[model samples]
Target: MPFSNKVPTIYDPRIGSPMLDAEEANFEEIALKSLGGFVLVLNDNGEIYYASENVEGYLGFHQSDILHQPIFDLIHSEDRDDIRQQLDINFHIPTSSPSNQFDIFAPPNSKYLERNVNARFRCLLDNTCGFLRIDMRGKLMSLHGLPSSYVMGRSSTGPVLGMICVCT
Candidate 1:
């Protein structure tokens, strides 16, 4: 995959699984092209797995700059510990529940250009891959929706996927 200034990194796809199906990849492309939306996938450990072509619209970052970075690095510190606790506890108990309503403010001097953003986080992998997707700029969170999160991860079959939480 190519990299850009908005995202400083990218990684090889997971070794075992087959590449995403054509229909799935096409669906992602449609999403990215429509609604001007972007997509991102983090591993159980929070490393960047894949990002949609339009990721910059939401993160003020490009997929190239995002690879290998812990998802928590993008989160606001004030909310990290509490969100972490929830993700960890949720893992042990096995619930993919939504969090209480809240917002994660854009960081000062942050990479993202648009201001007044927010997102609705989803625990996508509780049953299989075990990761999170911060849904951005949809009718989901608000007009300026942007999703981001941290995944410390857990073990599933073999991967050391941990825990994670989204700030807004």
Candidate 2:
């Protein structure tokens, strides 16, 4: 038998590449077609620092347009307090060692309602874009080497990275 050489890697048919360059990966232009949805990164300050290219399909705002904007801006006002409380609680919970896996808590009746949390919110696009509800799913972890403000949590040393999925 002839020897064959191929390195296996994580694959995404939508992106056509296992690993996207920093710029390409951050771009959410193709997020609309992805069943898995797009990725988002929020700093501990609750500001959006990174949004995949596809974010526009969900929120009608481009990634660049929303950068540095508070995540609360996208949330419906009625839900802000509840979501803020949940975020505070999440920020205080200590990470388990050995695994260091963080949790992403969503509001009641959310798409991934595995646990019971009182937080609930609707994600709306711009005023002119109309009403649209977006479901967010992601994890929280310490991300080093980011801007100082991103890591502004009371207890955590480094900036908290929220890797999330924006889904309709």
Candidate 3:
């Protein structure tokens, strides 16, 4: 008998490799579990790129069902606009003035900017539950080195915005 050697893959073969390795994925799962919230990644346009697996446990929607979908579709209609505004970089840009001219052009080196929002999200698990209020605290991150293939709308080289939403 001849021996055949092949490497085993952790993700679905049909979808190709995910950005995270098995160890990284496990670590993320543990961290999110401890925080008692699920992580959500969204593009500048509010399209969902990645969501932690724990989302199904908290929000009742599988990761596959929501990926590449507009996040607004899952939010309560009344709170959608507020979430949109918070995610928009333009909304947070500082006004230019003589004293703040340098500040406007040269911001801090931090990749993340603080973002906090409270909104009601539609619950898919139980009709009786309707919409569940969620508090999201996260950062508006600069998608500089992020893989474009992992992103929903843009290429890797361009200036892209992403948010890491921890919803509890």
**TM-score per candidate, chains pooled:** 0.37, 0.52, 0.68
Residue 27's lDDT within candidate 2 is 38
Weakest ten-residue segment in model 1 by summed lDDT: 137-146
Per-residue lDDT of candidate 2, residues 45-123 (tens digit): 5677777777675566777988888877877677566545544434444455222454334343133222122222333
Question: What is the C-alpha local distance difference test score of candidate 3?
Answer: 0.73
Higher-ranked by lDDT: 2 or 3 = 3
Candidate 3 or 1, higher TM-score: 3
Cα lDDT for residue 7, candidate 1: 31
Q: Per-residue lDDT tens digits of candidate 1, residues 17-101?
A: 3444435545545645765455544444445555565655554566687766765676555544533443232222213424332
Off by over 4 Å in 2: 1-32, 89-129, 149-163
Better TM-score candidate (2, 3): 3
Q: RMSDs, each prediction? A: 17.4, 10.0, 9.1
Deviating ranges (above 4 Å) for candidate 3? 1-26, 95-112, 144-158
